[model samples]
Target chain A: MKKLILATALVAISFGATAQRYFSKTAHIKFFSHTSAEDIKADNYKSTIIIDQATGAVQVETLIKSFEFEKALMQEHFNENYLESDKYPKANFKGKGDFSKVNFAADGTYSVNVAGQMTMHGATKDVSAIATIKIAGGKIDGSTKFYVNPRDYNVQIPDVVKGQISEKIEVTVKATLQPLK
Target chain B: MNKKVIIIVLLSIIAIGGGVAYYMWNKPKTNAADVKPNYILPADSLGAAFAKNEDSANAKFVKDFVALEIQGVVDNVFVNEGNESVIQLMTNTPDYAVKCYFLAGESVSANKGEKVVIKGFCTGYLMMDGVQMSKCALIK
Candidate 1:
């Protein structure tokens, strides 16, 4: 009986160590397009992200309709003609990296490679980028900037306004996550 | 036809085309306060609708560009990193709440535990963030 009790306690300890997760609901995700004719930008501040400290796993999800553009006409065209947000309202990213070298107890910024599957506009593609993880005051701040071609994700750009939009769109993700209690 | 008549017709076409192009370029964003809500109910019902079937809920409230007026007790209120006010309303699901993202520079007067009505457009629901509403306005 004594041995069995010790084994159960040890299992509980191991489970607790592997279940460390940090979450944030209001991550900021912004995308910009620049061209000779025009520069357009949109911001989405309601993205949800979860990071597992034990396994270095990260997941992010944001609604396509949540993105707000400066011009209503451009936003309408983006939804109706380009993205078709009514059909695919969510964009998701799931990736993992090596977090073994970093010590979460201390404050520092570490650069890591993140490889993931990005799903948007009903298309999924593999993506890899260098992401920065900043630890301060026991909080995790993760940020990454990357570029993606809209056509790769099946985003059709009409030829009439091709000059007004960039072929490659710049995407930035930033979030400050707190330990999940 | 006379050359003079043809010249006048061509000029008129160019003028009308310019006007239409300008209107499309200068269209305004949607303001929740200025538009009538397509659905009016408690926040809990909205949350439950999404919880039950996300696709149908999105098709009905989000894809159709439906505005909603939700009444519920305030779960919390805070300003996001973008300097926009965000209000969370209590729902039947303990793990989820209705998040309303108010327009920039909009003042939110409701306090925690207060029952209030909020008007906004349903952007859709994230599994982790529940139902999200943008361009929010305080109705009461």
Candidate 2:
């Protein structure tokens, strides 16, 4: 009888480890560009992200053509000329971090150091950022802000229109995670 | 020379004016739709049942109904349900749905395991065949 009880406890703990994985997505993604004439900014708050609590494993993806612009014509150019969304329809990220030892017991803010490979326009790069993580009421929230250069992902800016667009753009990401099981 | 130039300019104006009037009178009419401000994803819905297929052709991409194949459930939306009982779908997605009115004696819906592609403007009401407006239906 004691052996049966012990075995059940072991299974429960192991199951808990995997069951803690959570993810929430709203397709919320934003992009910004700067130019001498005006700043171009667009965002869609519907990006998707998933995280494994025990392993700190993170996977993120956003629709490339989902970026919204204020001007209809500008949006058309972005998809056809700049982002080339048809060829590369998604920007993806897959990375792992250490969350087991982190302080998640309280309802406060934590600045987490992250290192991962972000794939945009079919190219992957190492990325590191300080993401703010919040835990409350059995829910976990994460957000981060960063910048991307067009050249980093081979995004082309024609010289004739170079003055109309910015060289570097800011990107911000936010996600909420819910228990999967 | 000055008189000739002025005559040319006046004639040009007359021709252009006539052309403008003809174009305006013969141009195809566009159905202007109202902006629909509300679209909410259903709670805990997943893709399961298939949208009923009817033998329909000439189905306005999203005329009879508005639906989003979100997660799994067909979140069929109608700004205001009135006379249109069924809609033929041209596209469906997790985020949005586009459809049109069907007049052909045939029906079309997404096939099994097929996903919706494309996104478009959403409206608050449905407009019918340039004659009158129904409550509200999804349009392509």
TM-scores for every predicted model: 0.90, 0.59
CA shift at B76, candidate 2, in angstroms? Answer: 7.6
TM-score of chain B of 1: 0.83
Worst 10 residues of 1 chain A by lDDT: A97-106
Q: List candidate 1 segments past 4 Å from native.
A: A1-19, B1-13
**lDDT tens per residue, model 2, B17-93:** 99987775455422123433223232121110112321121122223223322122223322211122223232332
How well is each residue in A1-181 modelled by candidate 2, as lDDT tens digits? 9999999999998767654766664435677877778898876543567767677887777655445566546665776787775456557778876665455546877777777999987788887777788888766788888788888888888988888777777888877756655
